[model samples]
Target: MKIVVAGGTGFLGRHISRALLDAGHDVTVLGRSPDKVSAIPQLRGATATKGDVTDPGTLSGRLEGAEAVVQAVQFPNHPIELPRKNLTYDRYDRQGTINLLSEAERSGVGRFVYISGAGADAASEKTWYRAKGLAERALIGSGIDHAIVRPSWAYGPEDRALNRFVQIARFSPVLPQPGAAPQRIQPVYVGDVARSVARVFERAAWNDVYEVGSREVMTMNEVVHTLLDVMGKKRAVLPIPSGLLKMATAPLKALPTPPMTPQGIEFATQDGLVDITKMVQVLGVEPLSLREGLTRYIER
Candidate 1:
């Protein structure tokens, strides 16, 4: 199978690219900076092409001779939108996939795989979920044979979320919890997400959306405690008051690449509910447990 993976240099996309390559598929990584593809170890054996999904003109002939196309692109700092720089979900997640889908259709692609979020809702007011929901809706309406794989808080060595906490735990005696509320989340391993996307091709007639996540649904406090245990570190879990964090992330809205925004703070605290019935039954992918996933990436 000849497949073109948009944003193959990204965290999730790189894993998907490697999984497909290991499965004997001819993979071509499409990104704005194809030269940086060499820096990503997972994209080592894959071909690189200069194409930005945000710019549809660059996508011309990129998906040619490709049997499948995967939309796994993310902005400069994922989950943290820099609207001033036009790096929001509306631009990349929503418009980017739409643009890539247009090119995929023109290139005669057979299958499309979209990496959607766990609680994506087109009608929602949230930016990330709404963007993903609109893109999913577009893909379904495109009348293309596509599989939507919605991962639940995917974390890995290269991930920005959980790794940020891990990095804090290594240097500080107290691990700062995002919010005081028990924001439930099912953290899935990046490898499991990659595997799920790759397994989508193994089955026939998979046009439906599949949600993938671990068996454990834990709170933010539990997640960090478990992550600490996996890293063989003992730290006090200190919950930051939501009001204080919200006030602190206010000034970040003005930065070029804001590390944390007011919206991002809310996004981090939201519950990520997932149902893996189709993931296991249809795709035959059972995501790793949160503890198992943390152990795989965080060294003890």
Candidate 2:
């Protein structure tokens, strides 16, 4: 099988590309910068192509012979450094996804797997969720066979979220959290996410949305403490109110790639745990526990 993975150089995309290659499928990564695409240790046999999904014309001949298309591209965390107008989520998460779906349809691609985040609501007032929700609706309505995999909180080597906690815990005596610090999340390992996506392609899980997560449902405070313990650090947990977190993240609106957006902060304060029974039973995937997942990434 020939597979084309958009955003194949990203955190989870790298794992997915490698898993596909290891499964004996021909893999091609589609990214904007060809020079940025290198032969990853996990994807030694795969190829890379230079193309932007935001512009449908660039992807004309690139996806010609692919049997499956995995849309994994997303906008960077925030619009702080970039102009707010150009950095809007609609451009990439929504319009870019639509453009890719159109091109995939044009090329007669069969299986379409989308890596959408959990808690995306089309009717939500939040811009990011709305964008993802709109794109999801379009994909399902496009008449193409699609599988939407929504992971709770993805963490591993190169992970953006949990790794931050590990890094901060390494030197800090106390970890500051927001909103009661009880907001639960089931952080799934990147390799497990990759395995589940590959399994979906292998079994042709079409016209369904599968939610994936780790084996443990932990509070935000618990996650931080666990990472601290894993790294042999002694750190106390402090829970701040949600209002303060929003105010703290307000200044980051000017950053090009902010570690925390006001929207993301709000989302983080909410419960992000999901039911992964389908992925576990149908896909036959068992994700790592939080402690196990973080230990492999942050061996401190």
Candidate 3:
């Protein structure tokens, strides 16, 4: 099978691209900067193409002869940097996906795999979730064989979420948390996410939505403490009220490169747990535990 992966230069996208290549399929990575594709070691075996999902014109004829298309493009800043560089979830996630789907349908692509988040819902107030929900709806209604994989919080060596926590723990004696509420999350390993995505190409996975996550569910405080423990550091966790934390970080939003944002704080405090039975059974993958996955990077 010939597969085209949008945003294949990104952390998760590269992993999925590599997995498809390992399965003996031809893979093409589509991104804004095609030249930088060679810089990523994981994308070594796959070819790269210059295409941007935001601009539908750039994606013309990119899907030709491709049997499947994986919608993996996302705004790198995400909830942390809203409207950064004039990029938002609406423009990137929702509209970008619609553009890709339009091209895929025109090019006779049979399978469409979308990487959605755990809390995706059209009616959700959260910006990211709403955008993803709208994209998933578009893919389902596109008259294409589609599989939507809604992954919980994913983490790895190159991950921004856990790696940021580890970086902060190395320098600070105090770790600030959003609230006392046990914001639970099942952190899935990036490798498992890649394998699940690869499995979507199989005939059994078509027209289905799978929620991927590990077996362990940890609270927000537990996630931070675990990172501190893995890094061989001890930090006092201060759970401040969500509103106060947002207000405190409000001024940083004005900086050219703000370290944090209110939307990011809200995402951190929300519960992101998911049921992984479908991911395990259908994808035939057993995800690594939180400790096992974290230790792989932090201990290095």
The lDDT per prediction is: 0.89, 0.82, 0.86
**Model 1: how far is 139 from its true place, Å?**
0.4
Q: How far off is residue 164 in model 1, in Å?
A: 1.3
**Pairs of colliding residues, candidate 3:** none
Give me the candidate number with maximum TM-score.
1
Local error of candidate 2 at 88, Å?
2.8
Runs with alpha carbons beyond 4 Å of true place in candidate 3: 255-257
RMSD value for candidate 2: 2.2
The 10-residue segment of model 2 with minimum total lDDT is 76-85
Instruction: Kindly list the per-residue Cα lDDT of model 3 for residues 1-300, writing each as its tens digit.
Output: 999999898888999999999988899999999998888999988898989899999999999999999988887666675575766888888999999999999999998999988999977888888999999999888889999999898898788777777776778888777777787899898998999998877535899889988898898788888777777788898878888888988888887767788877887778887888888888788999888888776772
TM-score versus the correct structure, for each prediction: 0.97, 0.92, 0.94
Candidate 2 regions exceeding 4 Å error are 78-85, 252-261
lDDT by residue (67-168, candidate 2, tens digit) is: 888988866554222435466667887898899988888889987888887777789787767888888999899988898888888888877777667666
In candidate 1 the C-alpha lDDT for residue 130 amounts to 96
The per-candidate count of clashes, in order, stands at 0, 4, 0
